[model samples]
Target: MVFQARCEYGMRMTSAPDPFHIQEELKYLRLHITNFLSYQSAVLDLADLVALVGPNATGKSNAVAAIKLLREIPIHGLPIAIARRGGFDQLRHRSSGRPYNPALRLDFQFGDNPVSFYELKLRGMEGKRYEVKQERGVLHFKGDKYAFTNNAGTLGFTEMEGGHRSRVSGDRKIPVPAGQSAVSFPATFGLFIVARVLQLMQTVEINPALVGELQEPSSTREFEPDGSNTASVFEELTSETRAELVDELSAIVPGIQRIELRRLADKVTLAFVQELSEGKRREFLAKQMSDGTLRAFSILLSMLQESRPALLVIEEPEIAIHLGALRTLVDIMRQQSETTQVLITTHSADIIDTIDIDALRVVWSEDGASRIAPVAEHTREPVRQGLITPGQLLRSDSLDPASA
Candidate 1:
């Protein structure tokens, strides 16, 4: 039996009705980090395809982790998410001797609409407990700005409704609970939208070790972060979609005839069918496939997913990938960026060379704090003279701020 794909917002389809067509909306505008992890203060301007390249331990992964932490807050609450990362002490920057407040300020704009901003600040209190220092949100629409909610100091909650300002909780200051966010209040509709957008943000740290493992069949439509449920997801795709994926894979890796998902009474697994030199056919289980083949297949499945996230953050995608296939992988990612925003971290020159200079950001450390700058700012002469590519400058350490 063949299944039909369901089209939704931010999803790419071969053909669909008018109702399924929607313009690409910008979900994230900017991300500001202050005293969070290795960053003292830095702002990253988001784009369709963002690539972060730097030496190891220079806080490339930390930037991705910050987004993951923020994404978890609206779903799991604030305190639980902080505790999962070794508590507040570990999250705040330790370079300064004095106590610090770690904050994340995110700006969001949908389509051509006015921009909206949300800021969350946290500081360690007595008994090693963390509390919200200041929580505020604003929505700018139709030449007017609306402040959703502000919680700070002795002030309880100042909310704006229909362009009117009113204070809630009267004279007594209502403290936000340790595990909650002020913007998470259900009464504020604008603030709730911010929370919902954050909830939709997804991060994936692909692990090649888990990609080839067999597992129980699942009805999940989206690919998991670790790629463990790839077989199940492929089994659920439409016939047309599966054929398209097989064709793409065959082009990337020659001699591949087709990919099949085998189902038993208790388990489901993936089998790669290939054609030999004599036209002989052979099959290999997922675990029996090469690492590069398995990784490539998993990445291809993820890019072709019909129900992809609004923002997809992938860490070190170049790992376990063949050098010859890097160009194909880059092209696939660039094509998918039109529908879903893609952010990736890499140390591979081949991958970097394939990306535009405007899409690349250089991450480095200086004065015990991690910093990021656009590649255009660092390699102006080399880029103008066509002396070296961004990847070459990065490999030669010319993009490092400390070196400048």
Candidate 2:
């Protein structure tokens, strides 16, 4: 029912460890983007909070799409992933009267001063072979590390001296064809603990079409991208957490008092209803919730899983959420951000108005580049006056025209 823009994102590190328990680390998403037809350059420093607001077709979704593009490469085969989303030609933008550079690079910071950087130059594929024009990855530890690439043979370190570096490389760089991503190679064996946090927290995607099967609550099932398992997730919650979630959800769906996640007849299912109602709140197969309710449930539930993700990427968090519930949605999201880096993209002025003035970024597509810049200056007065809402400021001239 909601025709929303599509989005994509990524997260990964060298070791495989959940972020909640790691105490001595910091995670961030920084990009030095260029080569699009516009000659426009942007270094989007995604930190504690970042927001991009712009009009339709302004590339707000495109940037998010790139991130998801990167993530899907690892989860599903890249070809299938791309096709499922929109296909290759759709991936590139028509710019500068011609396509500019299609290169991409990312630098990830971890620990004290250690950093890991990956860069890839994407080009057209010839038949089944998409020759690599240039590719490189580096690990900086103790101020010294190794570098590897398809072009520049190993200069210093090829494999991590202490860990299994070769296996990581084979999966990340070896088999990926051109016009694709290496880190997203699911077949790739390495899952760095740090990288996974950022990646897992990367943008979230939901397919509304999948809602049909999610009508009922699913206690034993994992959360579906579409959020069909929301009722079940709450059903499985401890009494305390369930109370909290119910309190929160009640703010949105008037009757939704409690959701039960239970396994009966050897099957996991979700059960729920208006806190004030008597009969079945509603029986959904997990696919039956209103698009809006399901989307909200997805956001709330996903937060519980992170415990603490270095970065949390949310695509169109505003979709399906009622304008009235926008404030509560932002409040909970901010609460989650206290422990995880949060980045969201939305067109709703209401959603934008609630964001702290200092924590805003506006993304756009002009000329050819997908660019993002701080909207801090734009948000100052409104924040001080406490007049316009965060969401309003985000959508007003206070933000980019696309945002306005």
Candidate 3:
């Protein structure tokens, strides 16, 4: 008997037949923003691992917030999501006493096929209401393209294939209500790819304190953004997976023997077993563990989950962790990026040191708006000459366009 192995983004192939095949899919491509938060207009070409770096209040978190809001659109609908964030006025950027409409454009690709793009523009209307000024969806594949545009009270769709053009005419006009996305309409066909892509994007804002709290045991495999169900999720992992996590945790922090999820009466909590001297072991409850330890555990669990999202946005992962553990954490993030795209915001020089310059996006403020640039392009000479690490360039303020 022979076992056939399948290759995945992060898994290692062992004892498998024909392991050279590559499964490449475009999960996320590019994000363009205009008049959104502090960005008048900015575009980010997302990679597997992206590190956003800059000083405080430079809109690092704002970028994450934009993605988060976009993630909410498919679920809660555009109007409700905008309303939850204090309406369109607050979501849009106001500069120089001029009212600016907010716009977002996303590009997604599906497994070596041509790219699909979604563009949405929102404007504040009379009586504190907001309207979707323009919405468009385009899909290009194999020299053929399908596109639809909804603007100025009219909706139209076009299909171009083999140099022939056809319009969706004669009662084919889809009626997309104001403040709604055309992709969300049930009548729309061939746009499920865009919807599926949006569904896979996730933003995680972990709170270490939440990890310490008692949680009800559940069979959930997906970890929440706040890490509220970390203990329950840990309980769901198989023994082999749990052991792997323990090994990773021990590697990052010495003296950790094992992790146990114990259910007490009606509550479940995590316990960390530390190997004591003289061949003894001591157990510490989640509350007794250090902040850094709990935070590290949350991050490790998120990365090691069997079922994960396509894109994971983590904000400020360097908080409360020991500097010595930054390398291990960075390594875990990089490894996880092989399977899932990771976007991280950090102010730690140590975290920046472990990242490649190409993975670094220098975020800064210019003229009351936030801007982002690739670190290599922003700091050309020093990076090209190998004279400075990204960490060093950050500390020396060489990545700041305003300073230059």
Which candidate has the top score in TM-score? 3
Off by over 4 Å in 2: 1-26, 35-41, 77-85, 125-129, 140-146, 152-198, 207-222, 228-243, 262-269, 277-290, 306-310, 376-382, 385-404
- Of 1 and 3, the candidate ahead on lDDT is 3
Candidate that scores best on lDDT:
3
Superposed Cα deviation of residue 336, candidate 3 (Å): 1.2
TM-score of each: 0.83, 0.72, 0.84
Tens-digit per-residue lDDT, 252-351, candidate 1: 6777888998876688888999987787999988888888788778877886766566678878778877777878878878888887788889988888
Instruction: Judge candidate 2 at residue 236 and give its lDDT.
Output: 52
Candidate 3 lDDT at 11 equals 26
How much is 107 displaced in model 3, in angstroms? Answer: 1.6
Q: Could you give the candidate ranking by lDDT, starting with the highest? A: 3, 1, 2
Question: 64-131 in candidate 2: lDDT tens per residue?
Answer: 65566555544564566566657644554456345433455667755664677766564555442333
C-alpha lDDT of candidate 3 relative to the true structure = 0.74
- The whole-model lDDT of each prediction reads 0.71, 0.55, 0.74
Q: How much is 43 displaced in model 3, in angstroms?
A: 0.9
Alpha carbon lDDT at 227, candidate 1? 85
Candidate 3 Cα misplacement greater than 4 A, ranges:
1-24, 140-146, 152-171, 184-189, 217-220, 376-381, 401-404
